[model samples]
Target chain A: MIGYLDFVIALALAGAMAVMLTRLCLGPSLYDRILAVNSFGTKTVLFLSVFAIMVGRADGVDIALLYALINFIATIAILKFFRYRSLDVALSQMTKRIDQVEGGQ
Target chain B: MANLDLTQYLDYALIAMLVVVGIAIIRMKNLFAIVMLTGTYSLLSAAWFVSLDAVDVAFTEAAVGAGISTVLMLGAMLLTARDCKPEGKARHIVALLVVVITGAALLYALGDMPIYGDPNSPVNAYVGMDYVAMTPNDINVPNIVTAVLASYRGFDTLGETFVVFTAGLGVALLLGLGGRKEEEN
Candidate 1:
């Protein structure tokens, strides 16, 4: 019974991933693609967890945990790169630059 | 039995998704979108690897492919044009012909391969079975994967770590080791 539920969950996640892929490919705006990619990564994490349960292996959950952490870091890095246009910029400098712009306004 | 069939279907669906993502990545003009799609592609591959019971490979793919590669590509994108220049149809046709030939050759080779999970397969019948049997007695590690990587294959893992260290050193040197900044007093 539990295995059947896991199977259904896995199938649903796969379907959702297909939809996300479609959104990614047809997306006109860059943000759409970024969101789709991040969402897909999230789904992958969930799918890995479900698959691990289905297969009766506990190792898949560990990988899923790692994936979730990496996915977040990657998303943040991408967003930061887009915002600052440079990854090497110091956070202090970024905050000061933002302050200066806000002060001028 | 029923659940096994469902998992198999999931595997096929994931593979189909991978193919579609690969085609989309090749056809896309926007560099940023392409990078994102590549991340999606990597995540899909990681999921597929998990389904195949290759949790360790899936972990590496998730970390390197989905995480590090995406950030690296985004960094590289900063130095390049937003949109890729359109290529000629002739080039596409030539590339397609090469891909078709290589794929055909691989498919032909696949026919000679042993069935998946066959205990009689050459790979499963050899040293691998020995390791599986010996791990509990010799290494006493609960997870055979960890035991094999850290103990039996320790030298190979050490070499891989050394290679990674060298790559990190090279990157640091190239970037002037400026990963962090010291605040002015």
Candidate 2:
């Protein structure tokens, strides 16, 4: 049942996806960008699933599931990185103080 | 494509919602607002899939788009800065140019595509139909989505999972612990 309506829907999703792109450009925090990217991933899963339907296949659902799993893992990794980065920054500041005291001697 | 009298009406509504929700997600300044909108966008998209008569696809979209993506977004937020850095003029110019070019390119590509659900398109006549028709017999999963994901496309899914795992591991390894204190350094 291909129709003009489906095309409009697809394009609209594409437009919505474009909004996510805006977040990549204007996201207030780095985390926001990551969230936006994850949103994009979910949209992609939806898009592929729709395309699968468009092609009359059951395979798109399968891909979407895989994508969901992937998106979660990615978020986990990014958080992990952020946690470490902050700790490192703290350590560096302390080291600088120690070095200054020692160098004065 | 299967013969739903209400499908057209639903499809149009769904697409409209998708566009509106997407705009809201992008324009809202609050991080939480964006997250909620994104979820809504996914849910709306899943509903759109259902209207397309791809029940399996619809189910998958509902699960991943509605459920899992939000959880990930929340997790990432804990460590990330609360707000984005203000944009510079140079960056804004670059972003506008990129969006305009990419949008133009995509619109051009759309013209060559087959009409939505055209049976003669290679997508319909290709191996996808074979998977849908025969997957039930070989894999016996009533959910063709599952059958293809776990069976025919199992290997690819595995690779994708590995990528996710790697992303997590990298974040943990690189961002989690890589920042050494001065003492450690």
Candidate 3:
């Protein structure tokens, strides 16, 4: 039945999450850890969807969509911060370029 | 077989994994791995909340705990050293004792709590039921959580949104991303 499928999918997601946890705990490099966290976020989104089906609350899908968007933004922010040292520096540099373009125009 | 359901089994498994992950996080010395594990922990907790049928709470936890906090912590880690300094044995022991006592007190308090998902619990019998019953008539929204959060609790949500805005503004100011840039030039 549909309920059995939901249970199976949830169990599979949980198992995958367990593996990601181990990778996170034992990751040798920072990149590995970052990758693990990103993968875990993906799994969580899928898990939330499966859980919505299990509970018969289709509205829970909205939360899953929110999670997906937030997770993408967070990962991008973390990477940008890591590369630029300070987010302010990045923002300032962009604004300086914009001002130069305006002056040229 | 008679006592256990699929959801209960899933809950127990997830909790067991969470405890292991928590211990691993504490034992690890690498700051990056710790941050990553913290995200995993948050996701697990959010999943657990979903299992408990607290969709709104789960949503908040997933967004804030797993998403925003992880990015913030990563930003902090970038500004700090990657490795944690070893603590004194005495400090460690004191911290451990404090944690144990607090955890024990919390467990003791749990005895007075209503059983999980009990229909007759005061929470379910009162305001929770009122919200569920009236939500359909008053709000006409499919998702009661959204209706309550956006309409019934509009002011509180507004305050929360402002709090997030203020925090972002503070971060921008601290990082010199605000009007200070013009002053510097």
TM-score of chain B of each: 0.84, 0.69, 0.80
By TM-score, the best candidate is: 1
Q: For candidate 2, what TM-score does chain B get against the true chain B?
A: 0.69
Ranking by TM-score: 1, 3, 2
Model 2 residue runs over 4 Å out of place are: A1-105, B1-5, B132-149, B157-185
When only the first chain is scored, the TM-scores of the models are: 0.85, 0.70, 0.81
Write down the DockQ of candidate 1: 0.50
Candidate 3 docks with a DockQ of 0.34
Question: Weakest 10 consecutive residues, lDDT, candidate 1 chain B?
Answer: B169-178
Over B6-38, each residue of candidate 3 has an lDDT whose tens digit, in order, gives: 778779878988998899988998876787788
**What's the C-alpha lDDT at position B171 in model 3?**
44
Q: For residues B1-185, write the lDDT of model 1, one tens digit per residue.
A: 66667789999999999999999988887788888888888888988888887776786677778877877887898798888898899999999999999999999999999998798998899999999999999999999988988899999878757654654443343233344575542
Number of the candidate with higher lDDT, 1 or 3: 1
Please report, in order, the local distance difference test score of every candidate based on alpha carbons.
Answer: 0.80, 0.61, 0.75
lDDT of 2 at B48: 70
Question: Could you tell me every candidate's TM-score relative to the true structure?
Answer: 0.87, 0.50, 0.81
